[model samples]
Target: MRFVLAIVAFVVAVVLVGLGIAQRTVFHESAKNNLTVELDQANPFVVVGPDALTAHPGTQTVSVSGSADVYVAYGRTADMNAWLGDVPRTLVSYNKDKDRLTTAGTAGVYATRSPSPAPQRKDGSATDAPSTAAPTASVAPAATSAPGTSVANVPSPVGSDLWLNELTGQQLVTTTLSLTSGISLLISGNGGSVMPSKLTLSWPVDSRTPLAGPFILGGIIMFVAGLVLLLVGFLHFRRSRGPRRGRPRGLRGLLHVPPRPAKDVTSTGEARSGRRRRVAVSVSALLLLSGCSPDYWPSPASTEPAIETPDATAPVADPAASAAPKPGDLQVEPAVTVPQMERIMQRVSEFAATVDSSRDAKAAEQRFTGPALANRVANYTIRGTLTSQPAPPPIPASPLTLTLPQQVTDWPRAVLTIAKDSAAPTVAPMALVLVQDSPRTNYRIEYTMSLAPDAQVPEVAPASIGAAPISPEFKGLVLPTGQVGAAYADILTSGDASKWYNSFHTGGDQLVQQLGVEGQNTVRSGLPKTASIEFTTRVTANPILALATNNAGALVALALQQEETVTPNDGGTTGFQTGAVAAALSGFTGKSSKGVQRVTSIQLLFYVPSVSTTSAKVRLLGWSESLIGASELK
Candidate 1:
């Protein structure tokens, strides 16, 4: 019973506290005057407060000056809201500066003061509203100050805060105060020495409004009574169950029933003997069924299935299975011959010299089968006539050919043909390498072209015979390379360590580490400067680049423009531009992840000082979409 009462009291307390919080936020004080008094059109409200407002508990009188408004107690209730309710407030005192309103009251109040004589109205009639002009100064007696300060003198600045109306420049003095529970005041003051800008008296609203004190007192009284009653009942129960003066010991012993009985024989022995025998038989039965009884026994087997097995011998079927052999299976037919690859390379070289599309080379590349061929195809990038210079050796008797479902064109490729074996051939692993482009390597392009020469060149010239001849305004190229050391110095001076570190973390870190390892391994393998190198390539173009990629179909093809010249007269002028399609994708290998789209189109001008004259714009013009088909680029 006591536990049950405790739970009820706990729940009541929790609910009361929750209601209090909700009430605090939703309920507010309602004032009596609102904007009418707070923002009067005729006269502004002014305020005055204790000289030492921050002083510890001491009697202080606040005064209001210069207004004609009466104050009253603006009582606040739960029903009143901030927006719709009346402002509840009461003024405490006024200042004759002579301390005329010095009487203390239990509550603050608002007192009205008669306004000074009104000025003539604009329509030739007198009115209560103060004129837009400044108020006429009255020669009033000075106020008396506390102790050391004189009544006629201005007090120290610390204890007083003043607020002035922006338009009128009338001052208002503010002071702080706390109020009692369930009671809040919002009073406006008026009279002498009161500043119009600081006429406010507000208090925090009571969070909870419970039943009247009498009801709560009654409830608490009832709860105490109930607790007392409960204690009395418990005492009575104990007394009733207490030892009885006439109770027999033998009966008490029988109630307890120890395992062994006393040696002395007593009355009812026969009855006790019979009870003992029955108890023994019950114990014997419990022991006998211990293992079989549910409480002491193991659970039965579960009803769910114990195992599942798949059909290993089932036949699998796919229509494309015949088109391309699996990686491990080498039973597919051949495509291109060893001699054909050599011939392709030779043709590509000639095409590269002419800067023409190697579309046929891309077509022949797709006929390869097996993993080795696929691996080689995946790693190949921008394989064109220029890449064909270092031609590969003759293919083995059974060259590998990769068989992909997708078609590719206008790209020179390396085709490998896997041998006729049931097992797939493993391609040799390539060494890791990393290439760095420092600020020292930074290059910028600036082009200035003039009309081409009037003299015509022979058709045999590589640049003249293909497509169109160089523009007449083809001025020689000029490249100005800056010192890498100076670029490093610039980086240090720019305070860009964080940006550089972020770039390193992204992918450059791994690339650099891999490059370090490759360099070490190459030296260990007796290959010094001739170590296998991997290039990290980046392609960038003008803001017009965004237009080309997004509006490729709309852009019309233009004629090629080429030129050759030495270094130009500018900072890092080793960059040039030519109209051409650019396409590239990184991180492609035989062990590449599946389910990734790997193809894209690129149209960009290629520029490199080592490859050709950096000052010249070597234009390789073509539609990237036409050159690199919509096949995957991975």
Candidate 2:
């Protein structure tokens, strides 16, 4: 029984030692995980929507692998082009107050004018008064050693890093990404997109290296000691049996004593050796088991990696910088020192000047957003197709706005109605509306309207404090804000045909003469008398906005289309080369050269107003309309 137990212990120890080696080798191997994300862009920014990943615990080497392609947004291709032409320089200061950069012991370089060097006087004495001269920023700085002067020899703020803006996408991209702590592996800069882009992310996972060399070594030692115990224990049991002796079999035999009791000894004393063999083997087996100590086993790994101290003999980490931008950096809201309107105008000027509006008008994007951007693009394209020399409307000499400060609210907003008399009758002033949604976002042009002479504008809060955007549902106005757009739409749809026709005044704003039935009949009146004319005008289905007025009235903006089609009883076609209609319908050839001319007039400039007073008719404040599309159906 003892022999069997000893052999079993030795086998178990050997298996345990093998297991230790395998655990040390396999446990240290790294692991990998794959991640994929779809990204959306809001211009100059890309946001990742999927949840962030958590790497496994322990030291691990992580690597990210993937490919992505990004495209310029609708109007943004021009901004990129401008960047290629004359890239804007970055301006950075040590702090938010640009004026606070202390330099070279001088108060600053902002003196109105440099004092002319004191004139040399007789007797080698200088004049007390400074010489007069025109102001020049380029003047060389005075020597600090001069009387009443104290200055340091440092570079000016302009010469320092304060005036440089880095235009690279790399820093922005890397700074935008983040990872969980204590994860091992190579990670590269991973961030930013061109908008509506697809991205793939991959990294190694499941890597753990908690156990140390000592731990593995300890485990092996334990197994070896167990084996030794088993071998000795079995040998002693066999010796006690008093079997034949004299060099037992192989290694096992070497451990064996004579297989005879002490009283029955051979002349060579082999019998006595067997008698003591049981005690000797038992002692040896005990010592072997004790030899397997915890010191040989590996220790548990530390939590986070510590910055290692420099050592004379240890290999050091590479000095290369982690080029990624620091994750989660916060930026203060930028303040606009210039009026928001001016800021918008500057952007507009820059865009109109630099952008290739005919080919790729991306510069206009900064000054426009939403519908405004769309309209500009469409208009540019149409003008190019219709006229031999299409010129974008010149920016007016001065800004035409009601309030100096503009409206203020959660989203600061401004409405600019710019107009000028032109030799060209079809030309009208444009109403540009700018909106700033957040502190960080620049004010973008949201909506625009063209105005006619009779159009009236409602009173609004000053720019010092902007008006709050009212809900269409608000009932403060005699007409609910929401119903204002619909009401205007209704009037256009029915004209005299509407049951509420009495609610509108045709003669008051001359709207009736133009939009009423008479106006429709007059246009086709010029068409062949034999041709039947049909006029269909209705408010566009697009959203009508009612901005709240200080007087409880609503500044309503509405858009609609007016179409007049003429069909001739005689087989005569309306020629394209004719009257004022030709210029108006330039964009549309309608059934080209056919007698049936389908003139589709699309007028979009929807701003109008409704008063808060009860029983008051909707007011025709001024409005501007454009021939957005003129098509001739074949």
Best by TM-score: 2
Q: How far is candidate 1 from the true structure (C-alpha RMSD, Å)?
A: 35.9
TM-score for predicted model 2 compared with the true structure: 0.40
What's the distance in Å from true for residue 499, model 1? 99
**In model 1, which regions exceed 4 Å deviation?**
1-215, 242-634
lDDT of each: 0.24, 0.39
Candidate 2, residues 1-634, lDDT tens digits: the string is 5456546655665665555556546545644444344332222222121122222232222122222422111111111121112211111111124322111111222212212112122121332432222111222222222212221321111110101111123222221122332111111112222222333334444344333334444544555556567668778767878646664457774574767865555544875577568757765674565345442344564355522211111111111111221345321111121233343464454455454344344656645554555555555655555555354455432345442222221122334434343434465666655544322234455555556567666665454333334444444445554454445545655667866566554455455566556666676576666666666665444334344455555565544555555555666555344433333445544333334333232333333233446566656555434444444435
Model 2 misplaced regions, further than 4 Å: 1-338, 349-393, 403-430, 435-447, 450-458, 489-497, 567-575, 578-615
Q: Compose the digit string of candidate 1's lDDT tens values, residues 507-557.
A: 222222322334334423542232221222111121111000110111111
Error of 1 at 623 (Å): 99
